[model samples]
Target: MAELANCPKCNALFMRGPATVCKDCVKREEEEFQTVYAFVRQRQNRTATVEDIVRGTGVEEHKIREFVRSKRLHPAQFPSLSYGCEKCGADIREGRLCSNCTEEIQNGIQQQDQLNDIQERNKKKDLGNATYYSMKRDKR
Candidate 1:
């Protein structure tokens, strides 16, 4: 379903559908993609990184990253093309985080879980050892 939306690039009012950007922005992006692709497909430039693509083609870094993320520019074909990991800003070709950051986060979660388990066990032990006694009072 197409709905009226403001173009993110040019801020023009347009109908939204499969494309998040308006038609003009889309066409402009397509031209930019072609320029970037042409630069990259050259023998010497085949191994160009995202930064190199931005510099060589004069395309925005974010747009090139989007191209890679969307697989409009396949990383497999262009070996040196990669985008920054969301967590650490390290170069990554696939997911949001690089392997090191992903592992670090996973390990942190595991350690936190272990600590929580230990705390729970300690609480249970303390409850079991707690003494509760009823006091008997003489009626006056």
Candidate 2:
């Protein structure tokens, strides 16, 4: 027989399989379902999509969507919920950036461009100086 592994939710011992969650955790999850449901039911929060709930509630997107599809969370409560835009592989629930990381990326790119331009200008100046020296040497 195979040995047991700890459950991810509650760390209870269970027969290991594809599932990381144990039965007791499953029961606890069921008991806590209403807590998730009630939070989504608020007027200001209602109509939030799965992505919105993930952002607002700090729940995993996949988990929240599964709950929504399972009728654990009411779809009627969140009619306005929509998936967040994929910005540089981040879950941007409210804005384009999950953080200011994209701006940092852009700033890095701009810095690189400035450095490249400076190098090109230096290379041209060197070439011009070399040409001036060669012409003077030729006249001598």
Q: Superposing all C-alpha atoms, what RMSD in Å does each candidate have to the true structure?
A: 2.1, 9.0
Largest TM-score belongs to which candidate?
Answer: 1
Tens-digit lDDT string for candidate 2 (1-140)? 55689887788889877656898877766655655576687887776666666666665776665565455554455665433334565444344454667678799999999999999999999988884333435554
Give the lowest summed-lDDT range of ten residues in model 2: 131-140
Against the true structure, candidate 1 reaches a TM-score of 0.85
- The digit string of per-residue lDDT tens for model 1 on 1-140 reads 89999998899999999999999988998999999999999999999888888888899999898888888888999999888899888888998899999999999999999999999999999999999999999999
Tell me the spans in candidate 2 whose CA falls farther than 4 Å from its real position.
1-11, 15-20, 81-140
How far is 34's C-alpha from truth in model 1 (Å)? 2.0
